[model samples]
Target: MRTPLTAGALLALALAAQPALAKGPATSPNEAATARHYASLIAGSQPNMAELTLFFTQMPKGGDLHHHYSGAIYVEQYVDFVDRQGYCVNKQTYRIETDKALVAAERAKPAAERNCLSSAEIYADDHTWRELLQRWSNKDFFNHGALQPPPDRLFFQTFGYFGPVSNSNFKEGLQELKKRAIAENVSYIETMFKLSPAVANPDFDAKAWQNANDDAAFDAQMRAWFAVLDKDPAFNKTIADFVARIVDSSEGIDDERFTMRYQTYVLRLLNPSLVFSSMVSGFKAAKSSDKIVGVNIVGQESTNISMRDYALHMKMFRFLKSVYPDVKVALHAGELAMGDVPPEGLKFHIDQALTVAGANRIGHGLDLAHETNATGIMQTMREKDIPVEINLTSNAFINGVEGSHHPINLYRKYGVPYVISTDDAGVTRHTLSNEYVLFASRYKPSYAEMKKTSYNSIRYAFLPVAEKQRLTRQLDQRFADFEAKIARLAKTAAKAP
Candidate 1:
C-alpha cells in the first residue's frame, strides 16, 4: 500500500506540471542592474510617455501572431487602394462601392459628366475625408463611450467599408504591414485573411451540420459532407486559387528583417453548414501550400447565432482536426466580455474552444475569468501549453476590458502562456509597438517580463519547425542587441556633459 503524498509535495507536483513563465534562469547581477538602470532611464526621460513610446517602438518585438491582414493596413493606405481599384465611396454614409459597370459608364462620360464620385474624388473633398477616416478606423475616438454604434458594432462595421478595397490590394496591404512591422522592430507576423470562398455548399442536412450525435457520428457526418465536396472541379480550382493568392500577395514584401505567414479564417457568423464547409476549405488551402500556415474561425463571438452555435463550431474543429491532424488551428475564442455577452454566454466559450475545438492557441480570451470552471480551464491551458494571443487595443476598443479587469495579470499568476498581438491595428489605429507601450505603461511589468513575452510570441507562433528555430535564434540575438543598446544609452546619459 502506497502512502498518500503530503500537501507540500502535491503542491510542488502541480506547480511543476504547469507551463513555465517565459522568463528563463535569472541574468547575472550586473545584467539585472543594467536592466533596472535602463528602466529608470526610460521612466525618467523628458516628456516621459513620449520617451517610453520611443523605447517600445524601437524595442525588438518577436512577432505579431494575432494580426488580421486586411485590418493591418492604415485607412489612408486603404484609400489609396480605393483609388487604384476605381471604387466609389458614399459621401453621406462613407460606404465604399465597387460597381464596375457604374465606373465604366462614368469613365465613358466626360470627367465632369460622371454621376457617382469615385473614392479618389472623395479624397479630394477635404470636408468629407475625415468622415471616411473615422468610418474606417478608431481615429479621433477615445473609447466605447465615444463611438456611434455600440463599440462592437462599430468595430466590426469597419471591415465592411473596406471589403471591396481589400480584395484588390492584398499585395499593397502586405507591403504596408511589412513596412510598419519593420519600423516597429518586429520580426514575424501571422496575419489572418479570408481565403477565397469555397465551392457551393452541398445539399445540407441542417441537423447533421449542427452538433454531431457523438464523436463517431461527427466523423461519419463530415466524411459524407466531404464525399460530396470532393467531386467538384470548381471546389478544386477555388482551393488552388486561394492558395495561389496567398503566395501572390507576398510578391513585393521584403522579409530580410521580417517573416510573415498567412492564417486563413472562416467567418463563424455564417450558417453552420457554411462555417464548417469553409473550415474544411481553409484547412485544405493551408495544407496544400506552405504559404498559408493555418486556419482560424473569426467574427464576433457574443452574437445570438455564434453563442447558440458555439459548441457546434468547436465540434466542427474537433472533427476537422482528426482529418488534418497536422493543420494548425488558432481560434478566436473567449473574445466576449461581461456587458457584450450574457453572463452564462461567457461561461463555456474558452472552455469548449480549448477542450472540444482543439484550438492550439486562443485569440483574445477576454472572458477567461467568466468561463465555467475558470480555474480548471486555466489549469488545462497551462498543462497543455496553450497560449492566449492578447490583443490589448482591440479589447479596449471592442470590449471595454482593461486596467485591473484585463486577464494578463491572472495569466501571469497562473503561468498560462500568452503573447501580445495587434488584433486590427489599422481599424484600431494602433500597432504591435502600441500594445507593448500600453502594457508597459498600464501594467508596469518588468523588463524581464517584457523580454519573456516578446520571446514567447515567436516561441508560440504557428510556423514550421525549421522556421520557428530560425526565428527563435533571431529573436535571441535581437534581445541581446536591444539590451546592450538600452544599457549603453542609460550609462552614457548618466555621465552626460
Candidate 2:
C-alpha cells in the first residue's frame, strides 16, 4: 500500500502545481501578512524545491510521538553496523543472518561448517546492493510485477531481514535517529523500542485467561498470571536488563538539551503467553526506569492473531494498570481499513483502546470513521484529551488511505487532538520533512495552526507534568525564533534584483 505514485507522476504533479498557494486562515493583520509570506515561499509558486524544502525543514517541528526506533533508523546504517561487528549477510535472502555471538559460536565449531559471508562478499556487486536495499525498505518499489511479493509483505518482511542488525546497533542506531530528528527540526521523540526477552513461565496456564466469560473473571485470571510471573527471579532480571540497555544506548545524549523517551512493546502476533509475559516485563521496566515511559502493542493489527487477541490484550493492560499504576499505555489501534479487513473488524478498536484499555495515546487511528457510534467516539476522545499520533506516510503506504478518505479532517472537525509523526521513516523512505510537506501542501494550515499541532505532541506526551511545562516553554521560544528567520528570508527574497 505504498504511495502508488510513480516517479514520473510525482515530478509532473510538482511541476504542475506552480500557479498559486491555497489560502490559509486569517488572523491579526500583521500575523496574516506573515502567514501570507510564509505561504508564498512554500507555495507551489516557489520554483526552487530546495528553498521550499529548506523553509519547512527549518520550521520547528515540535516532536514526533509515534516513532519506531528500528524503523526510524536508516537500513544502510544497520548494514554498516552488521559489517562493523564482523557479521555477515545472506546473499539470497538479503538478510543480516549472523551476529557477533553467532559468529563467535561458529568459530567454536569446525570452521568449514560455518554458514556466513562478509558484507563485502554479499554486497560487492551493485546489483546485490540494490537488491539488499529493496529487501530492507520500500524504495523504488513501484515497478515490481504480480510475480513479486505484495507491498505490505515487502514492507513488513524487512523487519525480519534486518532484525539481527538492528538488535545489535542500539547505540549507533539511536545516534542516527537523533541526528536525523535534529536535522528535521524535531525536538522530541517518543520512539517505540524493545530490549526485553521474556523468560517462559513454566506454570503458565494460557487457557485461564483466554476463555474467561466476564471482565471480573478475566481480571482475576490475569492477576493470577502476574502473581506467578512476579516471583520469577530470571524474569525480574530481564526487566533490569531492559532498563540497562536503554541507559547504555543513551550514554552521552543530554535529556535537558534534546528530549527522548522509549515505549517498549509486546508483539501482538506472538503467542499469548509470550505477549503477556513481555507486557508484564515491559510495564515493570517502565515503572522503574526514567527512560522507558510507556508500553504499546506492535505488529500488524489486522493479522489473525492480533485481531483475535485485541480485546484480550486490552484487558491484560487494564489488569496490569492496577498493578503498575504509574506506567502509561499508548496502543496501535484502528490501523485497519475496509479494503484490507472486513467492515465489522473496524468497529471498536480505537473505541476499546480508549474506553476499555485506558490508552493515554492512540497511534494510527485510521479507522475512526468506521467505528460504531463514530461521533460519540470522537467526542469521548476530545473529552478524555487523548491524542492520536498521525503517520500520514505510513497510513497512505500501508492502507492506501490519505487526503479525503483519511480521518484527519474529521478529527479536526470534531475537535479531536492529533499530532503529525513519521511512523517508519526508514521503511517508507521518507522523513519528518516529507510528512510536514504533505500536511502543508495538502491541508494548507496557517502558521498558528501548524505550530499548535506541534505543541499538541508535547502537551499529550507521557512525560512528567514538570517536563511537559518545560517543553511547552521551549517550543514557544523555538517557534518565535524560526518565524523571525523565515520572515527575514521572505523579506530578503522580495527585495532581490
Candidate 3:
C-alpha cells in the first residue's frame, strides 16, 4: 500500500483531484432548474417523446435558417390559394390545371370522369383530399401501401404540383409562415423564397466549359461575362425588379419581435450559362436590397447537369464572391447519400462549398463523413466557426439518414457547430418543435447545448451584426420566461403524487 505509485495511478489521482469541467455556460437558477427537469425526462432508456414535445414546444427557438418559402407553406394553405386563384387540379396527375379551355373541357365530363376538380370539390371528397395531401406532402407516405416513387423524387416533385400557386399570394403565405413561427417561439426565418431570372448563352456556356478547371482562365471568362451583363439594361432591370418584388413581398414581415429575410436562389440543374447568369442576378438582387440577405444554389444535387458542372458552379460562386464579397451564401451542399450518387460525388461537395464557394453556412451537410479528409473538413469548419444546418425530419424522409448513421454524431464528436432546423416543415409535415423533439430524443443533448443551438441559429444567420445582437437579446428574455414556466411546472409535478 505504501509502495511508489505507478505513473498512470499518480496521473489519475491528480486529475481526479481537479473539478469537473462545466458542460456549458453558467446558468441562472431557473435555467438550472429547467435543465435538471429536462435531463430527467431524457435519462431513461426510451425518452418520452410526448413530454419532450411539450417541453420543446414551449422552448424558444431563436430562428429557422434553412427554410424554403414554398416548402414551408402547408398543403392546406396552397389548396386554399388554388381556390382563390380559380385554378383546378388535374385529379389524375395532381397537377394544377391552369389552362381555361382545358379546365372547362375537363369539367364538362360526367362526375365520375371529370378529372379537373376545383379546390372545394377536392376537399369535399375525403379520398381525394387525403390523396392530395399525400401527394403534396409526406402525409401517409410511410403509413400507407401506396405506389410510391423514390422518397427523394416524391419529395422534390411536390413543388411542381404547387408551383403554380406558390408564387401567388406571397403576402398571405409569408404571413402564414410568420404566424406559425411565432406560435412556436421562433423569432426569425431566412427562407429561400424564389429563383432569380436567368438567361442562356451558348457562347458563354462554351467559354465557361472550356475553362472550367483552369482558375485563371475561368476567372477571366467570368469577368468578361460580367462585363457584358453589366451593360445589358434588360438584365440590370430584371435584378432591380427582382429586388423590388422581394421588398414589396416582405411588407409587414418584420416587427419588433419577429423578423424574416429572403434568399434569392439559383437552380443548379440549369445549363452553365443559365446557372451563372442566375447566380449573377441573385448576387445583384442581394446587393440591391437589404431584405434579400443572401444568395443560394438549390436543386437536386444528383442531377446530371448539377453533378457534371458542380465544380464550375463552385468556381462561379468563388468568382462572384470575389466581386461581391459582402453578399452571403448558404449552399445546399452534401444533401446526398451513398446510393444517391457515385461514391466520388460525395467526397468533395461539402469541402468545395466551404473552400471554393465561400458558403458562410451549409444546409444539409449530410455527407460530411463521406468527404475526403473528412476530419480535416470538420476541423476547418470548427476553426472557422461555420455551422451546418441539421434537418432531422427532412434527412430522415429523403435520405434515410438518421439516428447513429447521421453525420450529426460525427459533427458533435469533432466539435463542429450545428443548428437544428425544419428544412421544409410543411413538406415534411413537422414543425420546429417537432425537430427539437427529434433532436432531444435521439441525441439527448443537454439543455445548455440545446440553448446554445438556439443561439447558433441567430449567430450564423445572414444578418448584420446589430440585427443578430437584437435578436439575441430578445431570445434571452424569451428563454428566461420559458424556463421560469418550466421551473414552475417542475415544482408542481414534484408536489403531485
Candidate 4:
C-alpha cells in the first residue's frame, strides 16, 4: 500500500524516533553516524530513503504466492514477443491485436504508423503512455489525474486488455516470467490460472444454478459438465501438453526456483450452480493431477452474484472437502471495503471463507473490521494458521485501503500470519520487490520479520510436506547468501569514500 501518512505526519514521526535511532550502528563511525542521523527522520525508524530503496531493490523476496502467472510477467516482454510475432497493438486502446490480417495491415504501414513504434519512443512520451497505462492498469504514474477510473476499475480492466496476448502462448510466457523471477531473486511462485478450460458457459451456468436448491438436479448438471470434459479429450490433452512444456522449460535453473500450481478459479459473479460445479470439477481435477493444486473463487466479491452466493460456495467447498480432503483451497474473501457494498454484506465473508469454505489461505483479507465479530475471525485464523495474502498495491488500487485503515499492522498485532504478495503485478505496474519496498519503507519491518514473510509462503503453499521442507532449507540458505551480499555491498560502499 502507498503511504497514507501525510508528509507532515511522516516528518513528525521521523523526528520523534530519536532515542531508538541511537541503538543500532554500523561498524564504521562515519556510516553509523549517517545511519543514526537518518534514523531520526523515519516514522517507522526505517533506513534512510536512499538506503531503504537499495534494500528494496536487493531484498531476496522468497516467493510470489498470490501472483497471476500471465500478469506477473513484465509488459516489456509481451511487447517484444508480439512484435516478433508481427502482432499489432490496437491504436485506440493499446490492447494487443493478434489477428493475422490486422498484423499484415500493421506491417504494411510505415513503422511510425504502427501501434507500438518503439520502447524508447513510448518512454520518450511517458506522459501519454502513462495515461494509457493507467487506463490499462491501476498505476500511480501520474498522481494528479481526473481522467482515470477508480483504482479498482482500472486495476481489473488491465487483465481484459492483456488477456488475449497472455493466453496465446503460456509456455513462452511462463519461461519469460521465470527468468525475471530469477533476476529479482524470487524462488517459487504459486500462481493463479484457469485450468482445463472447463469453465461453464454463462447461459448454461445460470440454468444449472436455477436447480441448485434441488441437490439431485444440481448433481445431474455436474454430471453433464463432467461428461462435457470427458467428451473433449482435447481439453485434457491441452493441459497435459501445457504441463509437459512447463516441466521441460523449468528443468535446472540455479538462481531462482519455480513450481507451478493451478487455481481452478470460478468467476464469483457466476450463477451459484456454475460456481459449485466449477469447485467440484476443480477438486476432481486436483485429486487426479499433481499440477492443479487447488480451487479459488475470484473476481469482485462485492458483486451481487458473489455476495448472494457467498455462503453457498463455502458450503459446496465444505462438501467437497469431505471427499477431496487433500485438495487445497485459497479463496478471495474479505476483499471489499465498508462503502463498496452494503453494511450487511461485509459482515461474514472472512468467517464463511474460513468456516464454510475451509480455505487454507485467503487472498486479500483487507476488510477485517467489516466481518461479524472480527475478533473471533482473527482468533479462528490464528488457531487454524490460515495466512492472509496481502497484496499491497492491489488493496491500495482496488479498495482505497491503506495505512492505518489497512490491517497489516493489526494482523501482526494479533499474531495472525500474513504474507505480502503481488495479486496482479502487471495490472499494478509493480514487481514483488516493489511491494516489499513499500512495506519496508512504510512499515519498517525488521530483517527477521521480512524473512518470516518468505517462510510463510512455504508454510501455506500446497506443495507436499517433504518438498516444503526441502524448499524451506533452500530458502534459509538463500536468505543467508542475500544478507552476505548486502553486507558486502555496504562494506564496498563504505570503502568507496
Candidate 5:
C-alpha cells in the first residue's frame, strides 16, 4: 500500500488544488504561500491567538464602512479637548462639566468635597482617570466586578459623556483617525459623521403618524413636505452649512495611500417631523458634496421611539430615495438581539431595510435568523449583491452576539456578501486588526475569503465608480505587499532552528 500522506502534505495539496476557493479570481503565488502559513497559524482546535493577532494586525483592511465619527474618538483624546477648552470633569459623575457657575460652586467647596476637577486634576487623581476610561469605553467592563449597566446601555451612554466635545475638534479628530487607520493598513473609511439639521412641524407629525402604516399616503404626504422644505430658507441654509462643515472638516484627510468619506445620519430617537425632515436634509447634504457619499439612520434601535418608528424610518428612506435616486443609503437594521426587543420586533428590520428602504448595504444585521422569511431575505441580498457590515466586537459588547452565534456563518453559508468592520473602534477600545483576529480565530475562513472580505469593504463602499476603482487598485498593491511579507516570514520560520 502507498504510504499515507502527512497532515502537512495534505494541507499543501489542498492549498494548491483550491487556490481560487473564494469568490474572486485565482490567487497569486505569494497569496497562496500566505494562505499556507495562515492555515498553519489557525489550523488546530485552539488556534494561535497571538500569531493570529500579529498576522491580522499587519494585514491590509480595505476600509471601515460602518464607522461612527464621535464614537471613533478615544476618551483620552476627548480629555485633551477638555483641557484645551478649559472644561472641568465632574468627579462624582465622571462627566465633562462646562457650566461656569457649577464649576465655580464646586471650586468653592473644600478640596475633599469638590466634585468638579479640571483635566490636570483628573490626571493627578489616578482613580478618577481610571474611572473615566472605564466609563468612556468598554475598558475594564467585563474584567472587573463593578456596579454597571447593561452592555448595550453602557455602550450608548458613552456618547452622552463625550457629546459636548465631539464636534468641537473636528479637524483634529479626523487627523487622529487618519493616523490610526494608516498604522493599521486600513485604506479607506466611510464614517457616519453627524446628524443633519431637523425642524419640527406638529401639523406634519400628526398627519404622518396617522398615515405611518400606509405607504402610498405617506409617500404623497412626504412629497408635499419636501416641497415645503425646498422653499424653507432656514432649512436650506442648514443643509448648506452641514455640507460646508463636512468639506471644511475633511480637508487634508485624504491622500494617495488613504481615503475618507462622510455619511450624514438622522437620529431615530426624534419626533416624526424632526426625523423625516432630518432625513431630507441628510439626502440633500449627500447630493450637495461628493465627499458626503451617503445618508444613514443611527440610534439605539431598541429604544422606545426607535422601535415605534422603525417602519416609518424605513419608509422615510424609501421616499427620500425616490427624490434623490443617486444618493446611497446604508441602514443600521437588525441591530437588536432577542431580549432587547419583543420577538415580533426582530422579524422585519433587515427585510424592510432592503425591500422598502432599498438600502445599498445593511449594518449590524444580527437578527438575520430571526427575521421573517429569513432564507428569502438572504436570497434577496445575494441576488441583489447587497453586503452586510459585520461588527464582531460591537455585536459582542453590545448584544452579546459572537462565536458561532453570530449570523456571519449563515451569511457565508448562503453566499450572501459580507464585510468585517469596526463599528465604533474608539468606544469599544479595539482596532480593525483585533476585529480581524476575532473573525479569523472564531470562523477559520480561508485566506482567500478574508482577502475577499477586505475587497468587499471597498467594493460595497458608497463611492463613485472612479474613486472605488482607485481604492481597489491601491488595495491590490497593499495586499500584494502584505502577502509577500507574510510569505517571507513563513520562509524565515522554516529555516529557523
Candidate 6:
C-alpha cells in the first residue's frame, strides 16, 4: 500500500530505534565508576589501589603480536637453563661462553662449586651478575646504577651476546616462552625470532651492497638464496627438525592454547641491495612455508644504512608482490624521532611502510606524530584498516617516550585501529598484565575499551580468517565469564559495607 521510499524510511527509523529499546543498560553503572576512577588515576587522583589492581588483573588481553621469543624469556631463566646444562659464564664480559675457553673454565672450578648457585642467587648480585642481564638485553635502561649504552646498541647487542645459546635449543626456548604467555592469560604469540636462511649465513655480507646498483646482479643473488630455502633438502630438513623439536618439547602442557608464527626479520642496517634481497627472500619464505607467516624489517631505523635503505625496502616489497602475492608484512616503522635522526626520515617511514611495503600491521609506530603529510597517512591507515602495535613499556624504556607523548591515544582519538603488545617484556621484566595496567592507569581506558583492545589483537592478526573468528568467539566467551566473576566479587565487596 505504501511507496517504496516511504517504506524504506520507515524501516530505517525502526531499525535505528531497536537497539536502544531492546538493549536497556548499554553502559553499566560499575563501568561508569571504573571509567571515572581511571580518569582520576590519569588526573593524579590516587584511586583505591586494590580496585585498580583488580581492574588490570582481570582485564583479558587478547594476544601479543609483537613479542620476540628470545627477549620474551626472562634473562634469569635463560641463565638458569644454561647453567643447568653445565655451561660456564665469562667472568670478564659476563657472556655465557662456549668453546675450549669456557669448557676449561668449567673444568677448572671445584666439583662442588661448579654450577652450584641458583638462578635466583645469580640474578640477585647487582655488581657482576645482574649487570650481565642488563647488557644482554634491554634491561640496562631500568638500572640507575649501571652505565647504560645507547638504545640501538643495547638492543642489537643483546642478540649477538645470546645468539649462540638461543639457536642451540629453539624448541625448549619456545616451550619456556609459551608457558609464560599462558601464565599471563595470553593465547597467541607471533614472535620475531630466528632469521630465514638468508639472514643466518656468516658469508652474507652486512656491508656488501653499500653501493650496489645493478638490478640483474641483485636478482642473481636472490635466486641463489631462494635455491637454498626452496631446493636444498638440507635447509628443509633443518626447518622440519625445528618444528618437531617445538612439538616434542611442548608435549603434555595444558596452559593457554599457544601457537607460534615465524617472522623472517631482516636487518635494515644492511646495504640497500642486500636489504632489498632480504625483503624478497623473507617474502618468498612466507609463501613457501606454513610456519612462516610474514616478513619484518628489524634493527635500528636510526642508522644511516637503515635510513638510506628504507625507500628501497618498500620498493622491493612492491616488486615481490607479483612473485608472492599472498605473503604478509608487519614492519617496524616510525621507530625513530626528530631528535634521533635526520628530518627526511622523521617524515616518511609510516607512509612508506603502509603505502609501499603494503604492511598489514605496523610495529613501534612511535613517531606517527612526526611523519610529514601525516594527515594523509592517518587517513590511508584508517581507510586501509592497518593496525599499529603499541608497546607501552618498551616505548617508555627504549625510545624514552610515554604517557601524553605516546601516539597511541592519538590513534584512538582519530579512530585509527591499534593493538597493544609487549615488544620485549622479558627484557623489561614486565608482563601483558603490566602493560594492560599501564593502559588503565595511564590512558584511562574504560573496561569496554580495554576489551575492544583485546579483540583488536586477534582481529588485526595475520591468522587465517576462520581461525581468527574461532579465537574471537572463544575470547568473547572467556571475557563474558571473566566479567561475571568480577561482578559477583564487586557485589560481595559492596555488601561488606
The TM-score between candidate 1 and the true structure equals: 0.90
Model 3 C-alpha lDDT versus the unseen true structure: 0.89
- Residue 238 of model 2: what lDDT? 74
- Model 2, residue pairs in steric clash: 1-397
lDDT at residue 195 of model 4 (Cα atoms): 39
lDDT of 6 by residue, 125-149 (tens): 5565767767776665755675777
lDDT of 2 by residue, 382-430 (tens): 6678888899999887788988899887777556778999999999989
| Per-residue accuracy of model 3 over 1-497 as CA lDDT, tens digit each | 02333557544543442222126444688999999999988998899888899999999999999999999999999998987887899887888988888877877888788888988889988988988988899899888988988889999999988999999999999999999999999999999998998999999899888988799998998899999997899999988888888888999999987999999999998888999999999998888888999999998899888899999999999999999999999999999998999999999899899889988998999998898767666766766888899999999999999999999877775567788899888888899999999988998888878888899999999999999999999999999999999999999989999
Per-residue lDDT of model 4, residues 67-121, tens digit only = 7766675566665565666665665667767678866776678966777433344
Better of 1 and 4 by lDDT: 1
- Candidate 4 Cα misplacement greater than 4 A, ranges: 1-47, 109-131, 144-146, 199-260, 486-497
Q: What are the runs in model 2 whose C-alpha is more than 4 Å off?
A: 1-33, 41-52, 99-117, 120-123, 143-147, 201-205, 208-212
Q: Could you estimate the TM-score for every candidate?
A: 0.90, 0.87, 0.94, 0.79, 0.94, 0.81
| Better candidate by lDDT, 1 or 3 | 3
Which candidate, 2 or 3, has the higher lDDT? Answer: 3
What is candidate 1's lDDT per residue for 26-133, written digit by digit as tens? 475544655675366346323257767777887899999998888888888887777688776666678776887776776687756654566677777876787677
Error of 6 at 215 (Å): 9.4
Candidate 1: regions farther than 4 A off: 1-34, 41-47, 104-116, 143-147, 199-205, 209-218, 252-254
- Model 3 alpha-carbon drift over 4 Å, by segment: 1-26, 104-113
Global local distance difference test of model 1: 0.78
Q: Tell me the lDDT of candidate 2.
A: 0.77
Q: RMSD in Å for candidate 3, one decimal? A: 5.9
* Model 2 per-residue lDDT at 160: 90
TM-score of 3: 0.94
After superposition on all C-alphas, the RMSD of every candidate to the true structure, in Å, is: 4.0, 7.8, 5.9, 7.5, 6.8, 7.4
Clashing pairs in 1: none
What alpha-carbon RMSD in Å does predicted model 5 have with respect to the real structure? 6.8
